[model samples]
Target: MAFSSGDSGGSMADINVTPLIDVLLVLLIIFIVTAPAMTMRVPIDLPQKSVNPPPPSNDPPPPIRLRVDANGQVFVNNNPVATRQVEANLLNLLPPAMQDGQAVEPADQPTLELDIDRDASYETLTTVLAAAKNIGMEKVAFLDNM
Candidate 1:
């Protein structure tokens, strides 16, 4: 903060770092204030159930199979279905007790077997997953190498 008198024959060439430090501190404060906002919670349709399914039944309904290929096409038991129809398809596959828009208990929840192709887009997978959750399917497993 020292200001040399102008009477000196040569001008001072030293860099003033006080102002630079002040500017940097201000920027640091601003970023810290905005950091939490960046991580604010968003309401997403996602399931919270664990992968462990309930005990086996005498003859449990067959698991629903979903296949997603590179082109983002979704197939249920080899039948092609649009991404938007997945929720409805899941509802149709469930039994009467689990199909009335009420949250299904884990024992009554159906298992979804996902066979994702090697080249499928991440978006396609997420979309299919969201549809399942929106319909409240809790048991899901990802098939490997297909």
Candidate 2:
């Protein structure tokens, strides 16, 4: 067999991947050495579970729906009631319903649900809330349209 360089030639030009493999091995070793130091150590205290049952419902009576229109008119239980008479009306109605004679239990107290029109002012809503508060009603909820 005879080998020629120029006119009578055979191709021997090919890229060897041995150098690439060596480089990748070196990078992998470097990452393994530095990986532990680069990570942030965190101490976590996870919560434990308990088999205790929840306390019984101390929920108030059925909610009284109060609607306030754009004109600042207040409605108690769907019936229109004057703004000035709101506190008075609530005071009169709530006590009797909750009280059996003199003693009124905490569980018997009714919740208040306020449904105000989009055009209604915040002042009117607050006033209605104030009335409920004055009448000793604690649980109050605002009605929103989905």
Candidate 3:
């Protein structure tokens, strides 16, 4: 570092950059050393790809059919069920294992196929939907009669 002796009558304008360049070179070397370590491969046990497709299991049980007539009549598998008893009827359609309040997996659950008439009132549709939902029925498919 050069300092004005006071006789020069002006401040020194030269910057001391030797220390800055040394620090930058040290940081550059540090980054270069760590870059290769960061790129080191981590051995992950990924699943092997299989060429053959998995064997198909037996067909799932038939879905429970629910039909609603224009007169607001709800039917469980063709059996007439009052609007209030819709939940009970649907519950009865489940397997014996599920009727005991055991935790049933979604795959093991019976699917409800709703065949609603076009002339059915919105109230009837919503009521039936609410009943199905209250029974914790996860799979409900709507049948298009067109």
Query: lDDT (CA) for every model shown?
Result: 0.83, 0.73, 0.82
Error of 3 at 33 (Å): 70
Q: How high a TM-score does candidate 3 get?
A: 0.57
Clashing pairs in 3: none
Error of 1 at 107 (Å): 2.7
What is the Cα-based lDDT of residue 3 in candidate 2?
44
The segments of candidate 3 whose C-alpha lies over 4 angstroms from its true place after superposition are 1-59
TM-score, candidate number 2: 0.52
TM-score per candidate: 0.62, 0.52, 0.57
Clashes of 3: 0
- Candidate 2 lDDT tens digits, 1-146: 23447875685566677889999999999999999998967443333565964443576456678889989899888889988888877766675754233444434666677888999888887778777756666557678954
What ranking emerges by lDDT with the best candidate at the front?
1, 3, 2
Which residues of candidate 1, in runs, are more than 4 Å off? 1-54
Per-residue alpha-carbon lDDT of model 1 for 1-146, expressed as tens digits? 44676788565667989999999999999999999999988576456666885576666777888899889999998999998888888789887777888875666566899999889999888888888877778778889972
Off by over 4 Å in 2: 1-60, 97-106
